[model samples]
Target: MPPKSKADGAKKARVPAKRKLAEEFPPGEVLTDNAKKKWKLGSAVGQGGFGLLYLDSSGSVGADAPYVIKVEPSDNGPLFSELKFYMRAAKPSLIGAWMNSRKIDYLGVPKYWGSGFHEKGGKRYRFMVMDRFGVDLQKKFEENGKKFPRKLVLQLGLRLLNILEYIHDHEYVHADIKASNLLLSYTNPNQVYLVDYGLAYRYSPEGVPKEYKEDPKRCHDGTIEFTSIDAHKGVAPSRRGDLEIMGYCMIQWLCGRLPWEDKLQDPLYVRDSKLRCRDNIDELLKSCFPSENLPEEMKKFMQEVKALEYTDKPNYAKLRGILLQGLKTIGATDDRKLDFGVSANDTGPPSIKVRATFSRTLKRRGRTLLASHNAVCIWKVPPGSWPMPAEGYLPTAVIVCNYRANLFNSAGSGW
Candidate 1:
């Protein structure tokens, strides 16, 4: 895409438009010259349950950045559910947006640019323009032979955790959070974005806490494998439900197969298949728990997760830390450097000063592009090592040394 012009950036920075009925037209609908004048349509990208996505050609020219134009046939009910959810949920200050933009870098959730309607062959179609996220997590997993590197898996886990935390915080639930819905930045693999809010909903609309409410026909709203057990029962989802689904996704990524894949062909067999994989599920949970080998803060977070009772599980902060730590642990390599220096001066009396600097680097795969420096100071030395100087004599000495050390400790020997 061309560099974001001042106008484009300002437009991007604006809060997404609220849902409006006028914007929701039936198929065979045509945009006014004003709306048509704003965007130039390009080729189709892909389609989802709600609409077809196309590349935008209008706006500042020469900007290769593509915007997805989502077109829904007019006969379908007003395409406002997803748009409503997107508008309510797309604020950068919101926890979900922050975690998504910073931690996961999942850019699947594109920004809303503009919307319009068109008519072709007597049918009305409504479309909205959004940023086009390139590849998805599913393709990446397949490219890695079904099982992603542990580090990448952990990074994915953390990103999902952040997304869940943000979603739950807003009293909403991402009814759908799966690999296909998870988008990646075009320029970076570590960046993962969540897209397609069509299925998202307020967690506790009407003051009713979200609980799983099963509907066999809609059982597939979210991907079958990544969905939580309660979701199959048709209960409104709880925050844990989202986390549980995320947990399943992580295990699937690590194992190269979904827990219920064998039974996936027959809906009746899915629950049993998941039960059969209980041991694997427990192991996955344990893998994410905190330990001495992991970052201390992360371990503390695992402790928090362990402490949570079924009804008392809304600790977004702890969960976020745990997921981040797990992500860091995957393909974690630590580099530490220690520097020591000494200075002395003498005249009538003598004095000396000593200083040390320590630094560490933690590396992980998959989310390396999203990495940021986190540092802590361990110790400090006081100054007072030299005597006072005399008018006729003066002496000084200085020593400096620096060394590097590897501090990373992992549960497994390799990824």
Candidate 2:
């Protein structure tokens, strides 16, 4: 994946081309002469509410591959936010370190190729080219009869936890974590990737502690069914929020539906259900899995996460180890192969592209990193209100308030 040559600044003009933010491009349009000649646009591979993804001329929608062109209305959208994130924090260099340190060649993230503006029908749009991914876990869950095997569910949790650690270490929280956002690498089923960072927020500035305050407008910031309690209160994202969201994801993956899945329209109802279930998840587990006890390790992991303050740094290794041990206890190997047990008829590679589009507008989401004067400031949620700790529990909030994170630095040092 190639890096974007130009650096983005506050109020900087859109690069490679600039157009009104509301422009959109349809099929058969060529964004650039260079793009037209090299990476021709194929069919409209996938379409979401505000944007449409097209397969590169050489790429196919249902084929196993590693690249696509994502387009959004130029001015303000998640795709633009994602472009900045990849260009800065989630750069190849950051992922490279994880790959080398973990003795794995790939970090569960898409390879960013480049980004620029495109035009069609006299309107300009923002576009990014990056690795194409195969079927998302949501579709996989639906096809596999909704419920993920316990082994696969545990392994997925472990894998996503490590990815969350890297993103959180870089000072960002993936506000939205769901089955649709988790994808199997098109080229390698053994590797999974976390995509879409539009809802992600910078919790701290490298090392400075951003005070805890909730923003009313930003409340219920993610998918209602799996959003964190902090988000439900309209606060900014933190590492804990990411983990809490993942906890819900893990439960839904194994159980097929969350206890509050049917109550998405009422965020309060969903939030309260999540709160109750978090305390007595064993009963929930018994009902869902029928044969398994509450995964004590998972319960402990969520408990510790809930105890952290808004500005606290998560114990990534400890949290990861909890999930890893769960896998070990189940006698499952971390071969990176998703353990959904391929049946005789399921021998071929999956033949669908996994992309999700949300209806929420970026305009409604408030200040984007693209428009902010200070890269990492503002947007937050309250802490010390999680319904965790039923009785005798102590809180240890770890705050490192004297460091800096270069969020979009191309160099990728301490991202």
Candidate 3:
């Protein structure tokens, strides 16, 4: 065999290094943006894959700081990707103009306040400033035992439609839309915001849309359980794909699980399952809500999503109408109130199977269930009380409780 050429070596180059975690910045540390605006950092409250989220404010940073700063290494890719979308489409004035033109009370999109590079300890970091948010929908979903009430689901669908249409019109598609990425307003829990634009794609450039094409290397490029068929096929994210993903989210939120969730490790299997669900929406509903009457509006919503083509624009008003009709059918109005309390709806909480691992761990710990609701248990633990799980006893289930998470230690004890 001939020796490999230099080009072959280049083609086989190593993948890029994972982004470095950001170091903590002390409270009162100040950073300036490109606009010459200074933001003071409060305590670090959260962290993401490549960065730390610090409470921030123009005045003295405090416990009630209304803004957050997401800081990552200057050379990292995720922050840069998100910055592009924010700089282009998430400016406050632009979002305000859209909401005014549409006559909507509010939009779910987060406004981009400011962003710039910061240097500390001889390291450069990239950061963006935005409004602080309350707990994410995923946490709320779990607290409610993985199922949102039917009315709440419809309300969420309507809000997401509004958000999707706004981003789509701005030429971007958020490839990943899951409960974890939808966050409530810090001051108003009723208002939700669609966040984490790291995977946002500019489907169209300067009013020109991209043609449909797929690459094997890009296959299964999003959250496997809820990703769209286009994402499974490696096609670039588009408006229809976002809607399709939203459909999946609504189904999961209402039904507690998707048919293919048990096999999420197999992306191709998951893809084929979604494809089959798209072809036969009834079967999908039946599998999800086995004993219950199928939600007619959900069926209609999925059917509408199925009809969309790769390059076609989505009928946002039609989708919103479907959800609005669903609200009407249930005798609920779009009051814009998001209730996260335990649901007492006719559809009882979906059956939950406690994993064998969790059961075994509980048995080993000699713990008895104190109370149970919707398959989640509640317990009381003293403050700062928690114990390390024995090796090889990983559990997948989370307990539903009313207490705030930070009240306990790092690992949850009382649940």
Candidate 4:
């Protein structure tokens, strides 16, 4: 028999010991960073697995605050994991230097502002300051009937290629890539930022790349739908893995769904589906885009991802070229504008938000049925048929769960 999942037991899965929920801090609470920079907090804007996010600004924190501060218990691991990547590679100077050298208009990576520790009521918390962002692409994706326009998808692919190349060059691999993790610029909707590095792994320490190795304990270490094949096999994330994940993101963004989305509760099943798709890229495309002309560029992109070895450095320029060519074929250019409007080719109207559900087993009418994982659809079940979070939940239309961090961050960034 297959191994029993966390939802198999009569009781719900217990929250891990180290996953401590953060206490909210009142507005105007002052925090002093190690650099002696004092940041005054606004109201708590968001919360994640083990952290609370507050608004901050040079003057008074308000709705227009330019920065957000993510605070977690000093003992939490997710924030610490993210801070290392930010400090090492996401510094504004580092990103600026790279942009200048590459001559690109802008990269999608988020800029790290500042980070330090704070003490409140004898409890220590870790905090990092970062630029505030606008709405996440996932929200936009849902609004557009769960599918992005073909041109927008290509533009996003090119932009993410720029981001993956930069982080890979810096020796870190962002193990997780999905719509929810991508947020638009607070001031410029055309500029998107990839955020939430809680699963970032330093595949290279110093200049040496880590050899390919799989650990069973590390299996399924990211968002199930978009995680790379390497991640499913328990392998440590690498450069190729980031590109693979990006490819999956683009496919889902354009096509609206994946073959294994309905089986996300079973990681093994999802992994197997991806393995089959990897062996036959054309079939995967045909299944997703049955009637429409196949996205030749997407097929080529998947082939490239399949050809990559565990340690091989991908030719990002070539991948970007493929997506650029795709845009051209569609009579579009990289105009740097993101259009979230409904596509003329969309099969149906956008899904109306009736009720959202989470991944868990529901005892309905004395029969156990597995609720779908992380989906936003018209829930057909009766009222009270679904489970709820212990502390209640937000009215988010869609929720993408991160397996590695067990985070519920929808405001688009820190966890």
Candidate 5:
């Protein structure tokens, strides 16, 4: 037998115990080297094993977006893990060509600011400065009655897929893709960001792919309901696993929950439930999408994802086409708006909400080129939208059509 690979060792990589955040840095503490003054901590906004995320007391850091400081003990938490990802994928120079090629201002990843060491009462701690984001999707989901608008679901899906493609191209896989890890811009609610790289791992290292073997001991490495089958088997995450997790997220977002969420404690059981669902998508979705049955297009998409191998480069365009097509079928627009709230009365033929039934088709298909092809189509006013030029309606549809669609253009600078 060939030398046993140490993939098993990944199973033993337990997170280090988190140190106390409050004990490390009290509110109003200013961290400085005097030689080059850094961040001053404000009130704590959030906490993680990495430490506390606080508003920047140093006015210098908050120019456009609010800057926040993260303080952590050098020995524990995800700050270091975050640092590695930023070093690789966030560097402007490193990703410049990649961004130019795609025509994206930024990869839906978090922005990295300055980082340094801070000492509080003889204890040394590391600190990083980064953009402060608004409420996360988990919070939004709960506030929206655990379900999001259909239009919102598709918009968020493509945004997330873009992030996945960018990260995957860079050799990393965000093993943990969940609501809580996604944040919105305080300045622009339309922009979605992927956060928390603590669980991210590179599927391919230095052009070599990790073997596809599973380790029973390493099963369940990500969120229970959303964890991929490979994760449940303790195998490293790959492109397929990322899409699998995203599929679960989309189902949960549209339906308000996944079939396996109730069994979160037993991750293995949840994983098994997901496997059962995948094996019988028709039945599972019959219960989940009862009105007209689940979108057949999505089922085919899942099949493609399930078919990918550990080393196979995902058919990025085909996978994205599935989502784009689904979005269009739902009458989703290129508009970045969540499409929530009660409809405003328009002079146009009363808003015709064309809800597609199983037999009636609203087909969609497209190129997955994020920068080149304008594949995302916003869910707009239905066919009944025939403005009589009566009410205060703009004659030009461009203004109201896809607000900020230009932001996704290939010629745009970072937004």
Candidate 6:
């Protein structure tokens, strides 16, 4: 795909162009004039090392349109690093799994559109397009007066745990898991979507596969308050570290602040504080644990968290139940109105688009083969076309697809 040029705009007006199917395309990809004219960007939502996030109003509204656009400054190093992570690891590690597994309707992950670059003022900017949500968990907590109900916090923890479990099963770690990174889908308030996989990594036996690891001294990733103790100590991250940070975030969500928030001023301070806190771990745990007024399930959950040893932490599913119970209690009394603006009325077969970018050798097989190393494959499904199965899993027909050509034309071919 060629980068969108001014001439492409003229071509789109004459006929519906195939390349114009997406309002935006990545750098080197082309967009038709019709798409360029139709796609309108809304308010800037947030910004990070990756780029800026904007509310997008392009294509059709509701199920047919994309709701958010992430704009990356063309030549920014941090933004490029973030984009590379998304392009190579983040999208495929998580979104690819959901799409491949036919779990598009899963409640806690973002539905990604394609990514693209836009040139303005003679400078190129990279951006990723994804489904926009109503608000982030941090915003929701603030709206509730900066104090989330204990039950709701527990529910959020459970949902996040399930998402983590899924990611871990696929051999990846969401290194930057925090409240701000979690978004609530407008269609379902209870449904949480995990965004910003910029720091995500796939775990290798030799540890993070070399290519993804950044220098601990020069490159620090993750929020100060939510980062794990080991991470703060510049240790190579493991699944345990991810869960530990999650545990801390859960405490912050329920209590409105973390135990070390007042004591730590920076990552170094946080590291030292963790050592001191660990020396008196019982006292610190007591301060962070929920009060007696907390729900029974939540109280049990907190106890479990306190008892979590590096060698014997509980599995995510067990913790998930406790969190879900807590959230249900809080949601029952939640005064926020549920918004179901995006209706699933359209009746059509799910549109599946599979695109592959390969960097290694390809082997020929009679009619099937697995995705090779260093390969990026994308499969997109329009909403309302494929409903999640009653059992919560998508059908094989919906999940299986090929790395090349129409991968789904035949069934039972695993990637």
| Winning candidate number (TM-score) | 3
lDDT of 2 by residue, 28-52 (tens): 5555423453455656677644677
Note the Cα lDDT for every prediction shown: 0.49, 0.62, 0.79, 0.78, 0.66, 0.51
Which 10-residue window in model 3 sums to the lowest lDDT? Answer: 4-13
Give the poorly placed runs of model 1, Cα more than 4 Å off: 1-37, 57-63, 77-79, 91-109, 119-122, 206-208, 211-221, 275-313, 327-415
Question: In terms of TM-score, how similar is model 2 to the real structure?
Answer: 0.70
Q: Model 4, range 253-292, lDDT digits (tens) per residue?
A: 8888988888778889989999999999998988787434
Taking the candidates one at a time, how many backbone clashes does each contain?
Answer: 47, 13, 0, 0, 9, 10
How many residue pairs clash in model 3?
0
**Model 3 C-alpha lDDT per residue in residues 267-330, reported as the tens digit of each score:** 7788899988999999998888744436788899999988988889989999889988988886
Tens-digit lDDT track of model 5 for 1-415: 0111112212114564434553545656777632476567777777776488878846543434277877787665578777777767766565566778878765567766667777667777777777778888888888766777666776787888788888888889998887878898877777889988877888788878888988776677766667788888888888899998888887777777677666666766777888888788776666566433366655777788778877788887787787778767765655766553322111121232322222222222433323322222322333445434455442322112223322121212211
Candidate no. 1 TM-score:
0.59
Off by over 4 Å in 5: 1-13, 17-37, 57-65, 291-293, 342-415
Off by over 4 Å in 6: 1-50, 57-65, 88-105, 205-221, 266-268, 276-281, 289-314, 321-415
Per-residue accuracy of model 6 over 21-133 as CA lDDT, tens digit each: 11233322322121343345655555544356566665433333346666655554444444444554445456666656745445465654556666655666666666777
Q: Candidates sorted by lDDT, descending order? A: 3, 4, 5, 2, 6, 1
lDDT of 4 at 322: 95
